[model samples]
Target chain A: MKKFIEKIIQGLFTVSGFVTSIAILLIVLFLFTEGMGLFKNKLVEDGYQLVVNKQNDVSSLSAEQIKDIFDGEITNWNEIGGRNQEIILFRLNDISNYFTDEELGSELEFVPEKISELIAQHPEMIGFIPQQYIDNAFKGKVLEAGKIGFSDIFLGKEWIPTATPVSFYGILPLVTGTLWVSLVAILLALPFGLAAAIYLAEMANHKMRNILKPLIELLSGIPSVVYGFFGLIVIVPLVQKLFHLPVGETGLTGSIVLAIMALPTIITVSEDAMRNCPRSMREASLALGGSKWQTIYKIVIPYSISGITSAVVLGIGRAVGETMAVLMVTGNSAVIATSILQPLRTIPATIAAELGEAPDGGVHYQALFLLGIILFVITQIINSSVEYVSAKNKI
Target chain B: MNITLKKRRSQHLAFGIVSLLTYSIVAILIIILAFIIIRGIGVINWEFLSTAPTDGMTGGGIFPAIVGTCYLILGSAAFAFPVGIMSGIYMNEYAPKGKLVRFIRMMTNNLSGIPSIVFGLFGMALFVNKLSFGDSILAGSLTLALLSLPLVIRTTEEALKAIPYSFREGSYALGATKLQTIRRVTLPMALPNITTGLILAVGRVSGETAPILFTCAAYFLPQLPSGVLDQCMALPYHLYVLATSGTNMELQRPIAYGTALVLIMIVLLVNITATVVRRYFANKVKMN
Candidate 1:
């Protein structure tokens, strides 16, 4: 009977292992299918455009003339000096504009490529995009569509990714805010976390370590939304009074909150790595006439640099990927700031701020996905750095 | 002697800096806990727990969310643990040391790298809409199972790997079949670790919000879930709604804090219990 039961158990194990692999495969395949499905539909209505002739004839305009119309730094549609008619430009959601609510909704479902084609076919049409994608594709067909010429993105400093009252999805403010907040957070928390880690790993007695270590690790598991509310009620108010600001939910408040949120991750990972450091190295540094602080600074930090890097990256990931907490406190405004004290929005906060109202597959939706892709790329870069550093260390 | 005095002062400075640093971490933890406890003590009554949520957010109890959390956790475990343990077994026992094992190991590492939102998008595409689960508890539970799989496999594999190779060799020497020895000897000894891993998985699935946002969490469901396939209200989403949406700011403000405090308490309790359980087995093994 026992033999029979054992046979069944072994059979189950082999069977289930196969199933887990299948599940992961299915997940990857499904994303590709949904994302690619939009491209499968072919375009039939490759349309036409208006432009100025090289012969100085305004009636018969070329594609270049039409594109120049849209890219114009001109004040009026007529200021491209083209026709007497106000250039009643029409561009689709995909290439023409970041999607309006109606376009993102069921009213029109133009994939970005279709919009690109639409802009390509119409000379009076305008396309809003990076200058790189804008040229050649729509060069002969459409002009730069809006009144204000495309400004250098770094110089254009306002973000309103989901502004219903105003459609301003320029990400400059959000990008800056995310960086500013994360920079402040890492600056505040990293030193404190590393110091605590040093003490717990090297200096503290076993009982002191035992009581302290798990407590810190336990704190790591606490959710960010909790931290956000704690900040919303407590930190926001405290900062408001301290600074005498009109509102408490400023960038400074957001950073402090993120600092607290990032602390546990930095401490736990750094401490664990420190504890695992070779004992002989510490001894050698001490014997070299190095004081404890000098040894720690010169020897221990260099030894654990890879681990500390991982901790920093993880903390940054936590700060950047965080949505609900920062969203609640950063005043959810997408305006750029000159100082840390001003309220601002981050990319994640922008997404969380507007994802609910966004129509799926809309330009806004794609932009959000684009935001996801950007964030994924950034995190991937950080991760690659960790791997590169790890490989270099040979440890 | 003069050099010694200089060295001692530097040592004291290092100690001071380190002590100050540790005190900051401890101070933050104390402040957070104290704040939560002070507010939570006023909010967490038997009535608050037992009764259903009302029309307003502040007065309602979180019975449904709690029940939904339990239901999703149980469902996720039912789906994930068996398959995860099997994969671990395959790696440890049956699979030869080959390229396939190496590939599988790399894939597991890559699997951990995929962010929770990507998993959310995956769930949205595959389970929530494609499979027509339509934001039901089943979809949420299944996606969570997928999220839980890597953790379960990693932890279980480590646990199985830690078991002494001699025990398995002795079983083989007794003329036992590979399957027979694994079932009768290897599995029983590793059961404690498997339990510990499951406890950790529980904490993971309970707290995770990203995947379920697209698969499981309902924005407003006054009633409790009646079946596994039904839509559900979860704690994380409830907290999100109360905190983010301003339709009822007057009411939501207090509830958000109250819910957060409850969530922190529950997760802490669950984690501590799991740690205690792990230590129990570890000490027992040490004694033997």
Candidate 2:
């Protein structure tokens, strides 16, 4: 009976472990299913295509160029590396401009055929209409609609996700903004965090260490939204006054908030590492006439460099993944950050701010998911590398 | 002798600077806590604690948000505790030390590192859209459960590791089976630590704004939630809306402070409870 019960318990354990592992798999699968589905979307709206005269040398057009042509920003074919001719834009609704309603008839039943004929007449003419309107047997050249490309998604500078004709899904600005805030945050946080960690681990008396330790843990436990509120009420105004800027909200404010938020992580991890340094090393350094500060700087730090490295890496991971505080304090300007004082939007902020309203399965929604994938991969890399360093150093 | 004097002066300076840095961290924490508490204490009252909002959330109290957060905590704990404890038990007791265990550990770490907002996205996709649960409490709880699972597993495993093998040996030598030994010996020894982990998980689930932002947070619902399916106001999300997009920002500023204060108190309470549990267990062990 005991053996049977043990078997049942073993089976339960295996099943639970298997189920726990499956959860992570499901999250990644769901993210990719929605994110990669963006690529399968047609550049043009469904049931519509762009057609030009067959003689036109341009066999394909980028979404941006098409938008430009339609918006009348680029009126000449020569501007797009094509023949030296003025481009004529046509929409199905613009048929009356070319042919009178009386001439084309009120029903406009043949408007599709006439639009195709109109396209054939002018080499520079680009017409957008129902895909069924274009007769394949006719001479109109149908522009091969391209799927959303890697360059368009990753390298594109504009993030206008609701642009007419096509939404721009470029993530350059958001990605750079995220990096800038996190970079500044880490830079500001590291020295102070290290100093505090060293003091707590090596210099502080038992009473001081006991008091300060729980305070730091409590700081870490404070909800990020509270930190964000603090940033709004305190840091934002402080930056504005200190820098004499027109607005308080900037990447600098976000960075400062993130720095504060990341401090507890860095200090805790690095201090633990410092404490873990064998007592004999510290005794020997002191016996050699090294001051406490000198001993910590030389012996304790060197002995646990990997642990400190992991601490900083984990701190960076926290800063990068942080959304709410950064979202609240950063001006939410979706522009590439020119300076720390300027307003910027991080990827996490963008997703948090925009995903609520974006229609499901829309380009905007999918782009947010893609941003999530990027964030997931970036943080996963940072964390696993930390894990690897710590694991490697374990022996 | 002059160089040695200069080195001594520099050492004193370094010591002063490091102490100053540590004090500054403490100062920052105090300033934040003091500011919130001073501004927020006045706003906490019976009416504020019991009543729902009125006049565009600028009047009345944050009762619904408080209840919603409690519901969310209860829901997530209900879902995560059993699964996480079970998985932790497996990893500690039954699982062999091998590549598979390593992979599971790596994945658990990875899960913890994934941004809470990304979890929001996943929750929105899987629970809200795919699972057709809509923006409901059940969906939010499931997402939060996933969020805290890694934390639970790691803590559970740590607690289990702290139990000596000799205890298990003694139980087995008494003719107890593996299951009985674990049930009768290991789990009791580990319960205090497991409770600490649960308290910590509560702190996490309550404080998290990003994951619940999409999954269940309502913009402004004054009444208490009637069912799991109904959207409900939560403390973090309520604070977010009041600060960012609510109709009258300045008017709601004090209320937002109160909400922040409440959130901080709850999280701090959970943290303190966990610490107390840990200390109690440590003392118990010492006494033994």
Best by lDDT: 2
**C-alpha lDDT of all candidate models, in order:** 0.70, 0.89
Cα displacement (angstroms), candidate 1, residue A190, comes to 0.9
| Candidate 2 backbone collisions, by pair | none
Model 1 docking grade: acceptable
Query: What is the per-residue lDDT of model 1 for residues B16-61, given as tens digits with 9 covering 90 to 100?
Result: 9889888878888888888887877777777766666777675677
Evaluated with TM-score, which candidate comes out highest? 2
For model 2, the superposed segments whose C-alpha errors exceed 4 Å read A1-6, A45-47, A53-57, A83-85, A88-125, A129-141
Candidate 2 docking quality: incorrect, acceptable, medium or high: medium
Q: lDDT tens string, model 2, A45-128? A: 656888889888888889889889988999999898889999998888888888877667678776776777788888989888
Each model's TM-score, in the order given? 0.80, 0.94
| Highest-scoring model, DockQ | 2
